[model samples]
Target: MPSKKDKGKAKATDAPPKEITQKDLEKLAKDVDKIASKVQHRQEKALAKGEPIKEKKIDPAKEAEMRKKIEAMVQALSNMEQTGAIKASGRKDMGDHKFWNTQPVLQHGEDVTEEGPIDPAVPRDQVQQEPYPLPKEFEWCEVDIQDDKQIIELYQLLTMNYVEDDDAQFRFDYSAPFLKWALQPPGWRKSWHVGVRVSSNKKLVAFISGIPAAVRSHKTLHHLTEINYLCVHKKLRSKRLAPVLIKEITRRSHLEGVFQAAYTGGIVLPTPIATCRYYHRSLNPKKLVECNFSRVPRNSTISAMVKKFKVAEQPSTPGLREMKPEDATQVRELLNKYLSKFDVAPVFETDDDVRHWLAPTPEVVWSYVVEDTKTHKITDFFSFYTLPSSVIGNDKHKSLNAAYMFYYAIDIPEKEAADSYDTARYTKQRLTELMRDALVLAKQADFDVFNALNLMDNSMFIDDLKFGPGDGYLNYYLYNWKCRDIKPHKVGLVML
Candidate 1:
């Protein structure tokens, strides 16, 4: 993910040109004349001061050539604007994606029929042995996440300077325990937890990390390093450290023979294989409205809004229980079977990987399963993790407790399936029941809201569960790989 404070820059020029109006040409001419007059006046002042200003006289043909060149430059800039190089959102187009343009990602509007890496793999020995050079006074270091003090330092840095809502009303507050749980997953590498610190005071200013995963796209499965949590201090954004952090992490991953990476960001970069929207369900409508995280309807009263979103204290699922260590193996089999139906998904090779990601962790992750009472088989499961956001300047609430929906699965017997339509209906019915129970559990836990992306089969229950569409959109990117654009329903992998 790109840093919220320090996004990289780039350039592009393949767009077609738009016609330039005569009035526009006249305005460009006048602007050039004004610049020439300003320069002449500066030269005259230098001569009066005995600075011996050197002057060059332009012949008529040379002057015409200069004017023509200036017009061409103006036309190119105008073309850029017409092609959305300068967007209404104030984001630059693919041509201006300075950092991503140099990487192995696809450019905007590029089509793909065959999926493969944009760059071929290099031998491990050919990978960079030394870390990329940092700006003067800033040195690269591997963050020791196991140490409590170092983890606290990382926590503080992210809490104060990480991703925030556009209105600045809230900022992500990833807890210390959550950081450790996310960064130290299965196949984690200590060396991939890259950080930069100030040499003078030893203050950590920037960080980027990667964790190994096996991801399947279409018929091919690839081992990839999932990159995330990229952040830079607000004051150091001008130093262009975000790009450096990205390059350094990529180098480290390459040294381990991983050639492709996956990530998600709120902002658009060179290109995205899938774009997903966030949907939120209010658990505590009054708190959300008071904190400006949401608003009460203009026609509805606070009491009405609160009553509308209220959930039952108990879950509806009969055999639902918190997941235990023994449940990991069954959950992994169920999840992998369900995920295989998607176009892109993760490959959990062992029960350990499932336990690390889906098993319950107090105050960090909560997973539950529905077991068949007679057969004692795990038939369904769902999970959500805590990711609270600090409610900026809100006196009533200090933080908005949020539960983000994670991996989930439901068993559908192949022998009972008559056709695709019946299978779709069965899946929808099972997921809706499971998710409703999940929402009740979240409400009982005192979460202010429950959030989920419009990915996988979430579209089946989002509206039925009263989850309103969010303003944010997350774009999923694959580094060094090109794949056909996927719809939200076809995306099974979720990034932290």
Candidate 2:
């Protein structure tokens, strides 16, 4: 009763499903069995090799129940994947990532304890006591740097022992000009300078120095004393005398009504919170190549690019000059702009931070600025300040000669948006040029060495200058601190 087309359709429908022979089913089963056997063998070998088995030590009934539960989960996942209801991989949520990364897994029967929140304001218990007893022969005497002879001896000792190690940019040579500037009278406090001496011999052996922190926007209500230039003579390093010097300095700080102290050093020595991150930039392509500072390139493009860039000098179009009071507003803008690119930068709120950092005691702080004279706009700036050494003994008046570099910036023109990388390259190039200028200034000023930290991206810039990696690194430890909503700039000093 059907038409010809209907009969054809029915014939197509009548075709039986293609038959899978028993041999095919058997082959599939064998393949699966082989795979399962291989997995079991691997697991067994691992166990024999002392790898812990995943099996939990539970009652037999409980073990069986757990296996069933796991099997159920596996089956549910398989079904969901097969039905295209869920992804087979890359299904991680934020919570899953956090849990995987941060959450600790507890072992069975392990005790669970919670750590109370940390209080930064409360100082932790001292771990190690002062290594050596205070020398009875040495009288705890503070030296009046006002005395020209004492000041000259102090400078001589610092220049001899604490002089710039090979990697310093600005050399701290103990010059007569510097002593005169440092010891210039009335307001300079003797309490800031302390020394230890053997009552028998009037040799100045150990020394410490502190300076008031007065940078605006970065100022602390409590006077902060920076402890720096701590060195024991090479022969005396083993005497465990560094701690005594540190304790003595602490006593002085407390006497001065100072509760907090900060210093940067190479070793993660005294305090853990003081450990700072180091950033480096490469200046000399040949040096970078020799030192293995350059990263291995994934391809030739990067390698060729670096080689080409290295051969060329960064363009220096802007003129540089000493920073003036009028340049504060522009300096602040530039600082804020450059610093915002980083996670941490010096906190500068008011113009005072700029003044203090740039002009701190005209004799101690030196600042330089690069400008577009035609436009009367400042384009870049950098500053450095002197940090004195800690006091040890009166006879061994050893001063640690050092200077800190701070607040550098560069601005790229709007027209050069496409060539900003070139602008940055030029900016870095300018640092080298300016450093040479700083060196000349430092030599005249009689500093042993100009010390600056390679924080964040500045590390990259520092390497370009051929500066030796300093043993000293600055660190940050926060106290009674709440996380501020604002993110800091990446390039400048992070600590206030």
- State the lDDT of candidate 2 residue by residue for 44-81, as single tens digits: 55655878656432242343344334322332232223
For each candidate in turn, the TM-score is: 0.83, 0.47
Native-to-model Cα distance after best TM-score fit, residue 371 in candidate 2, in Å: 3.2
Local distance difference test values of all predictions, in order: 0.80, 0.46
Best by lDDT: 1
RMSD of 1: 19.0
Highest TM-score against the true fold, candidate = 1
For model 2, what is the alpha-carbon lDDT of residue 153?
69
lDDT of 1 at 272: 76
